[model samples]
Target: MGKMAAAVGSAATLAAEPGEDAFRKLFRFYRQSRPGTADLGGVIDFSAAHTARGAGPGAPKVVRSQLSVCSVSESDALRAGLQPVSTWRAYGLEGYPGFIFIPNPFLPGYQWHWVKQCLKFYPQKPNVCNLDKHMAREENQDVWEQSKALLRCKEVTKRRPRSLLEKLRWVTLGYHYNWDSKKYSADHYTPFPSDLAFLSEQVAAACGFQGFQAEAGILNYYRLDSTLGIHVDRSELDLSKPLLSFSFGQSAIFLLGGLRRDEAPTAMFMHSGDIMVMSGSSRLLNHAVPRVLPSAQEGNLPLCLGTPLPAALPRDTVVEPCSVEDQQLCASYLKTARVNMTVRQVVATDQDFPVEAAEESERDITKEGICHLEDKITHGKRVRLDPDS
Candidate 1:
């Protein structure tokens, strides 16, 4: 029989028997149906046809199977429904990537309400010194030098503390609240504490996590002309653990790219309350923020300050931090600084290894035994040994 006719015949047979051999015959039919493709392509087409089979008497029916497959395909497999599978190049990243849009996951109107409420708490800007401005001050050079000198003197020890877990929790919470007021530092997981303990338990329940650790929140602020150098957050982190980052602020273009730092990067417009988790071999990938385009603001949406957002804020106004009427006064002065909190788990220090303690215990036993033998020799006396020893 001709290839096409054979395919049709096998498909009919598979419909009747529904066994492995019949399934293979149906797959071969589809493989021969494709015109002018490579042999491997034909094989793949056959496999796809077999895999895409509709349900049968003993299996799920075609309609139900199609719906289930389509649902998973919609939620996790595609990005914006415009790109084809395996063609990461079409997404501008040239690497397999996925994006999820959680529409108002922070509770509808919560962002706007939070801005209005926070304004009430600190009606007038606090008198606290701005770290970035302070760092740029001419007279502060001496202080900066002195601080750097002090940091030089400090030992950079990677010792595991008992309260490492507590530190992780505190840092995560601090990042959530934009590091408001109270001083909190990141902690590694060694001596697990309150925050670390909670995070570890939560992560453990989530499944598939190899290891976990937390670092103190690092606060970054950008002004109108400020630009962050293009760089990836790859140093000092385990390649095995995926990094989870949460952002709050005026939006910015988050550029993600391939493994090499020089490769062209794909831009993702990340906004307030967006959570980005990167892992599965993409952990060490090169990514960065090239610039914050001022022209991308949302006009009708609310602003964090009591002034209207200027026309220059780049991306669309997917999120409004405050009401339209209130933010019209001081929005321009807000500087669009975004706070990002990155959560991760670092490997424990070498000193924390159980093997080191065991080795030390063995040495102590040998030393004590030698001391007893010396004592017997010095006294020149016979000593009875107990079998129980």
Candidate 2:
């Protein structure tokens, strides 16, 4: 047989030019360090993730084609310090069914800064980069930076000071569920990050969500001790759409079992910057993450993607780039953990997300709760869970 086609091949050399103004406005939000209103002006913002639908991301000047957005040449990824794990059947119906993993598309420095911004996005703040709540904060702990001084001095602290990303038992985003009430609370709904908005659109194009629109985001932060039980993603009004998942900072052994828990699950590796899309059959499968492996840390991941890094953030632009020290620090931190951000369209349109339900203050306690779980699929015969979990 001919060489297997890579899911993210270098055939197309299109660059991602979402524009300076877009970045400026966006990073400005980061610079200011204040939480703005979570209520977006219109569905247009929500439609940022959609492909071939409405317009595309950063298209105020010219309409960008889907191919252009999704096409990140191998050279670009490599130059950006990343590599695509290739496979002929890595994606598509004829290939390995419905799941695809494209490793490290963004350059390490770029990705590092982007992730930092995402972690500090205020609205998602505190909980976004949470610390172990069960353990009380030590008066002498440096929450932002892990200290080696304590170990050097033999002044052992009661517990290791870890970021939320380091020791989170579990964390959820987008819509918060009232477990006692078994209903989603409107009070808890917040707009997904705009920086990630375009990314959803780009990945949607690659995954064939021709009309992808981001309605929700669920972030699963894990340490080595963590495990995600089997579940599905069916809370959205439309099942036809796709859910885009991104893995960062560590590797995990993901099990793709058949339709039920009774059957055994096949194992797969999920590393940093790997993208998983759930469309078609793989969208519905029984999957679980039983264990996490330490990631082969690559914050300065050296590849030759051929894309040039921005020399500077632009004048008056003035947002801080990740210092070499910062990237090194982050790389060290991510060496043994993982953060999974899964974005899905809860409803195709604003109208589809029931207005009445959002307005309702409380859920009916007498009714059985809608507990949807599960995520993208992999190689297997199976029934999956909802995107909510």
TM-score of each: 0.37, 0.57
Q: Which candidate is the best by lDDT?
A: 2
Candidate 2 residue-wise lDDT, 1-389, digit = tens: 01112111111111122333222222222222211222111112211234123222222221232223345444333333333312211222122255554545554345565445434342233232123223434521343444322222322234644444343333345564344343354555666655565567656655455567776676665554455655566555666777788776666655444454443333345656666677667676666665555433332222221222355643432134666544544455554456677877766554455675576536532232233222222333222212233
Candidate 2 ranges with C-alpha deviation above 4 Å: 1-96, 122-159, 163-173, 177-184, 295-320, 359-389
Worst 10 residues of 1 by lDDT: 366-375
The local lDDT score (0 to 100) that residue 272 gets in candidate 1 is 59
In model 1, what lDDT does residue 137 have?
33
Top TM-score hit: 2
What's the lDDT for candidate 1? 0.32
Cα lDDT over the full model 2:
0.44
Clashes of 2: 30
Q: What C-alpha lDDT values do all the predictions have?
A: 0.32, 0.44
RMSD of model 1 against the true structure: 23.8
lDDT of model 1 at position 214: 48
